[model samples]
Target chain A: MYNDIIIENFSDPQHVGDLESADIELEVGNSVCGDRIRVQILLDDNKISNALFRAWGCATSVATANIFCDSLLNQSLDSVCQRDVEYKQQMLGELSPSQHHCMDILNELHQLLSEQRVAEDVANG
Target chain B: MDRQQLAGYFDYNATTPVSPAVAEAMTATLGQFANASSNHAEAIRNRNAMQQARVSVAEMLGTSADKVFFTSGGSEANNWAIKGRLFNHLNKPGHIITTAIEHPSVLETVRYFEKQFGFKVSYLKPQSNGAISISDFMAALQEDTQLVSMMYANNETGVIQPISEVAKITSARGIKLHVDGVQLVGKRAIDVEACDIDYLSFSAHKFYGPKGVGGLYIKENNSLSPLIHGGGQELGLRSGTENLLAISGLAKAAEEAKCAIAQWDQHAQACKHLMVDLIQQADISVEFNGDTTYANALSNTLNMAIKGVRGEALAVLMDKKHGFIISIGSACSNNKQKTLSAVLLAMGLDEERIQSSIRVSFGQYTTTADIENFVTALNQCVKQLSAMSFAS
Candidate 1:
C-alpha cells in the first residue's frame, strides 16, 4: 500500500542543518509518526525571498520539505501578502484535504511569511 | 551466494512446521471424513476418532478427555476461558489478577472484560527477571477476586511463570486459575489436575500441528458460560461444527510431542549454547533482558539488547543480506504502532534498551548451523550499524 513512499531517506537531506540562523522559525508536524519539519523563512520587504527547511522524518516529509523550498526561492515579497490570494494560489496549487496533514508544513511556511509582513507593517507605523 | 544462503527459523514459540507424522495422520483422517455430530454408523466412527484424538491431547496434558474443549487456536481458546469465566461470574464482578507480560490473547481479553463488564484487573508487574512472584499475586488477591490468570510461558521472552505455585494459592483461597499455555504446551509437561488449574489454553500450530485448531482444558464442573452460544458441540460450553480433521491432527501432534519433549530439550540447549557464545564474543556491551537462570524461560528463546545499534535497522539488514527472519517483538503487536515492547517496560528497562531489544526464539527444527549463520550475520550488521551511527 505504501510502496510509492517506500524510499528510506537515511542520509541527511538538503537544508537540514540549523534554524538557529533563521529570523522567523516554524516547527510543523510531530515526532510520534516520525516526522518533524522546521521552516526558516528569510523575509525581505514583506515578501519571502528565501525559504529553507530542516526536516527529520520519513522519505515523504523530507521530499515534501525539499519541494517546498524549491517553490519558495527568489519569489516576490508580495507573494505572501494576506490579500494576495491569487499569488498564493499561483505559488501553491490545490491538494487533497488529508494532504494538509503534510501540507501543514507549507501552511506554516505561508503563515510565517504573513507574520513577518504583519510585523514589518507594525514596525514601519 | 543467494542460493547458498544459510536459512534459519527462530520463531518456534510462534509456530512450527507440521511434522511428517502429523501430516500423515491428518491425510488418513481426511479419507474417512464423516460428520462427528451425526448419528449414522460412519458418524459414530468419526466421533470415535475425535474421542481418541481428545484422549491423546488429554494424556499429553495429564488431564481427562471430558475437560478438553477445542477452539480455532490459542487466541480463541484464551477468549473462551477468560470471557467465559467472567461471563459466568458476572454476579461476582470483582477483580481479576494477571501478569503484565501475558500474550495479548490473555492481556487484551482481560482488558476487554474490564472495559465491557466493569470488572477490575490487577496486572501484576514482573520483576527484573520477567517472572511474577507468587507473593505479588497473593498480595493482589482480594475477597471479590474471582480469577488469577497467568501464562505458563511468555510468548515474547519464553519466561515460564509458576502456574503450579500460583494455582496452589488460588485454589487454597477457593478462587479460579487460568493458564495461557500456548508456548508451554509442547515445550514442557502440563497437568491441569496436578496443578489445580481451572482453565488452560493451547494451540496446535505451536507444536507442529495445523493452524486454526487448539483446545482449552477446563476442569470438570468448572463454572464457565459458553463464549459462543449455539448447538451444544463441546458439552454446551463451546458451540460450532467441530474441525474433526484438525482435531485428529492436533491429537497426533500432541502424541508426537509427548514422545519428543526429551529430544526438543537438546535442541533448545544447543541453541542456548549458540546464544551464550554470541553474547560472550560480542565486542559492544549487550545485556540479556530477563533473568536467564531464575525464570523458567525456554532455552530456545533469547531476548538481547545491544548497547548502541538500533534493532529495527539490524533486523532489516539481517533479512536483506542473510535471509535471517526475526523480530523486534511479538508479531501480533507489530501493528501500526511500533512500540518499544510493554514487556520490557514492565520489567523497568530504560527506553534505549527497549528500543534496541531483539527477540530470537527457536524451535525443535532450529539447528546449530542456523544459529551460527545468524550470529555471523548479526555481528556484521551490528558492526556496520555502529560504524554508520558514529560517522553520522
Candidate 2:
C-alpha cells in the first residue's frame, strides 16, 4: 500500500538514530496502534544542524519519520515548526486514507519542539 | 535471475501452480466449446466429460460422484453450504456453531445469517496449540444448534482440526456438519464417509488444479437451498453452466494428486526438515508459530517468528533483495487490516509474536536446495532487519 519512495526510505532510512548532544529530543507513540517515534535535533545559530529519528511501526510510519527528519536538515527551527498540513501532504505524496495518520509522528515532533522552545524562552526571561 | 523465477515460492497454501497434467487437460478441453447443458451431441460429450471429472473429484475425497456439486471455488462452496442450509431453514430459528479461525467465506456467511436471519452462533476458540478442544466444542453445543462449520486444516498455521471427532458428536446430536476441506483434500487422505461429514468444501487451485472451479460434497438425504437459482445445473443445487475446461483440469490434478499423495507428503516433510536444519545451523533465534512437530499439522507448512524482526519488513526484504517469497499471514488477510492474524490471536499469541510471524509453505516441487536457498536468504534478511531494529 506504499509508494516507491516510501518503500525505498523504509528499507534504508537515511536519517535515523539519536544525536547524543541534541538540543531538542522528544519521543511520541500511539498506544492503541503500537507505533513509536523518537526525534532528535541539534541546532546551530537557530538552524537545525542535524535531525534524526527512530521509529517502530509499520512501513508507512517508519518511512514517514525518516522523510520528516530528512526534510528538516539545515532548515531554521522557525520554518520547521511552521510546516503545516500541506507541507506534510507534499512530503508524503498521495497517501491512502488509512495511512494519513502516519504523518502524525511529524506533527507530534513539531509540537514537542515548539514546547521545548517556549520553555527555553521562559527560562531565558 | 528475474524475480519470478528467482523467488523461491513458500506460499503453497495461498495457491499452487497448475501442474502439467492439469494444464494439458485444460488446454485439450478448451477446444470443446459446446455448452454442457445443450441437447446437441457435442454438448453431450461435454456433459459426459464433466460427469467423469466429478467422479474423479469424488474419488479423491473418497465419496460418491453423485454427492459432489461443483461451484465457482472454495469460497462459493463455503458460502453456498452455510447460507444455503441456513436459508433452507429460514422459517425455523436456530443456532450455529463454528470455530473462530474459519475462512472469511464461512465467517461472513454465518455473520450474515446471524444479522439478517437472527440465527444465533457460538464461535469456538482454539487452544494454545491452535487446535479446538473437543470438550470446548461439546460444551458449546446446544439443542437449537442446527449446524457446525469448521475447517479440516487451518490455512495459516496448517493445524489440522479434529473434524472426524467433531463429526461424531455433531452427527449424534443430529446437527449438520460442514468442513472447509480446501487445505486438507489433496495434501492428505480424506474419507468423507468414514468421517461422516455432512458437507465439505474444496477448491481445485489449492492442489495444482486450475483456478475458478471447485466442488462441495453433500451427504445423501441432506439438501441446501440453492445459492444461485437459474439453469437448474449442479442438480439444482448450484445453477450455472459448468466450467468444463477447469473442471477437466481439476479432475486430472485430482487423479494425479491421489496417485502421488504418499510421495508428496514425503517430499514436503523432507523440505520441512531441511528448513529446520538450516535455521538451527544458522543459529537464528526463532520460534515456530503452531505445532512444529507436524503431528497435527501439514508437513509442507512452517509458520515461525524471527526474534527482533518485523515480519512485514522482513518479507519485503526477502522478496525484493533476495528473491524469496514468503507470507506474513494468509494472503487474504494481509493488508486488509492493520492487526495481526486472527488465527494467532485466537490461539493466545501475543502481539509481538503475531507481528513477527511469517508463514513458509512448500509443495511437491519444492526441493532441498530451494529450502536451503530460502533459509540462507531468510538468515541474511533477518540479520539485517534485526540490526536495523536494534540500531533504531
Candidate 3:
C-alpha cells in the first residue's frame, strides 16, 4: 500500500533534492495525479557517479523517489536504465499496486536515457 | 496520529464506525446461524429474525416489509436495480434519465448498460445549487423512457435532489423511479410512499453499521428480474446464504439511527457551525461549491475550494503534520488522483476552483475541539502552501 511506502521512508533516506548539473535526467508522474519527480544522473565515463532527485508530492512519493535515486548511483547507466528492474524490486521490498506508480520516475529515466544513447549514435554516424 | 490511534472521526459520509449498540445486537444474533430458507425449526427461527429485521428497516423508510430486499452494499443494489430492469425490458430499447452528479454506482451502471445492453441514458445537469430542475427532467422524458435513477442526496456535496417532483413526473409517465438513497436513508426522513418510487437502494455503513449490508426497496407492483440467482435466497432475486451477522448489525444500526435522529441533527448542526467559524476566521479566497441556503444539502457537510492550493496536496499535508484526515472526494477514487471531481464539474464550477476543492464531512463522533484544532492547522498549512506556490 502507498501508506506502507510513506511509513518506511518518512524518517531517513540517502538522497533528496536535485543535482546541480547532470548528464541525464528522468521525469515521472502525471499532472492528473499531482505528484511529479525528476531523477538526475551524474556520469563518470559511462558509469553513473551520483544520482539525486527532487520530488514534489505526498510523503510516500517523495520518499520513494529519493530512495530510488540513492539505489541507482555507482551503477553503469545502461544497467540502471535498460537492464535493471531490480532497483524498484529492491526499494519497495515488495510490490504494491497503489505504490507502483511511485516507480514511474525510474521507468521514465530508462526510456529517456535509451533515447539519449540513440541520439548520440545518430550524431556520431 | 497512529493508524490505530482514534481521533475525532468526522468523515461519516465516507463511512461510519459501527455503533456499540448495533455491534451487540449483531453478536447476539450470531447464535442462530442457521440458513433462513431451510425447513427445520432453526431455519424457521432464522427466517423469522430476518423478516423482523426487514420490517424494522421498511418501517424506517415508511414502506412495507415485503418491499425490502437485502444486498451486499449500495453499489450492488443500484447496479442490480438499474441493469436488471433495463435488461428485462430489452424487447424495447428505452431511454433512462438521471442527474449528472450521481455516485459512481449509478453513473457507471448507466455507462455499462449503454455499452453492453444497448440502452441510452440522458444525464441532466444539476443547477449551480446542485439540484436538478423538474422542468428539465420532464423535458428529457420520452415515450420509451423506462427508468429514472437519481440519488436522494449527493455523496460528494451532500446536496439533496428534487426527488419528489422527479418521482411525480416519472410516475405520471408510468416510468420506474430508482433512487440511490445511500446518503439520505438515516440522515434525513424518507417516505417512499409519498415519493412514489418503484426502486431505492441504501447501505448500512453510511448510518453506522457493518460495511457489507445494504437493501433494495422494490415496489410489489413493479415486475423486475433477478440479477443474481442460485440457492434462491432473497426470493431468488439474490443467491447464497445470508450474511446474518451483517444483516443483524444493519438492523440494529437502522434502529439506532431512528431513535437518535434528534441527536444526529444536533451534532450535524454543531459540526456545521465549527466549519463555518473556521472558514470565516481564515478569510481567504474560498467558495462553497454547493447551495448554502437550500434544504437539499446535509448541514454537516462542506465542500470548499481554498483559493490557490491543490486539494489533494492540502489533504496530504494535513495527514502528515496536523494528524487530520480530510478527503478530496470519495475515498474509493481518491487514489486515482483525478484533478477535477466529475460532480463538481457537473455543477459547472471553473477548472481552477475544481482543482482546489476538498470535502469535510462531519460524523456522530466529532467534537468542537477537533474542529478548532483543524481550523488552526488548516490556516497555517494553506498559508504556507500558498506562499510556497507563489515563490516557486
Tell me, by DockQ, which candidate is best. Answer: 2
On a 0 to 100 scale, what is the lDDT of residue B145 in model 2?
Answer: 92
> Considering DockQ, which of the candidate structures 1 and 2 is the better prediction for this target?
2
Question: Could you tell me which residue pairs clash in candidate 3?
Answer: B160-B296
Among the numbered candidates, top TM-score falls to 2
Q: Which model is ahead, 1 or 3, in terms of TM-score?
A: 3
> Which structure among the candidates has the greatest lDDT?
2
**Please, what is the whole-model Cα lDDT of each candidate in the order they appear?**
0.74, 0.84, 0.77
TM-score of each candidate? 0.77, 0.93, 0.80
Better of 2 and 3 by TM-score: 2
Candidate 1 chain B, which ten residues in sequence have the lowest lDDT sum? B329-338
DockQ of each: 0.07, 0.27, 0.17
TM-score of 3: 0.80
User: How well is each residue in A5-59 modelled by candidate 1, as lDDT tens digits?
Assistant: 2222222234444444665676676434334666776766644556666654333
lDDT of 1 by residue, B1-392 (tens): 12233255666766788888899999988877677899999899988888899899999999889988989999998888888888877776899998888888889999988998899999999988888988888889888998888988887777888887888888889888889999889987667798999999999999989999999999954588788889888888888877888998899999998899868877787778777787578665678888665237877788888766656555655665567877773111211344568899898887667767788877776767777778887887776555434222
The Cα error of candidate 1 at residue B329, in Å, is 3.5
Q: Candidate 1: give the clashing pairs.
A: A47-A77, B10-B361, B72-B212
Per residue, candidate 2 scores C-alpha lDDT tens digits across B1-392 of 13345247889999998887888889998889999999999999999999999999999999899999988899999998898788777899698999999999999999999999899999999998889999999999888999999999998889999898999998888889999999988999889999999999999999999888898999963567888999999887788888898899999999998899888988988888889999999998889978866579998898888777768777877877776778884211222346668899899888888888899998977878788888888888777666545353
True contacts kept of each: 0.00, 0.08, 0.16
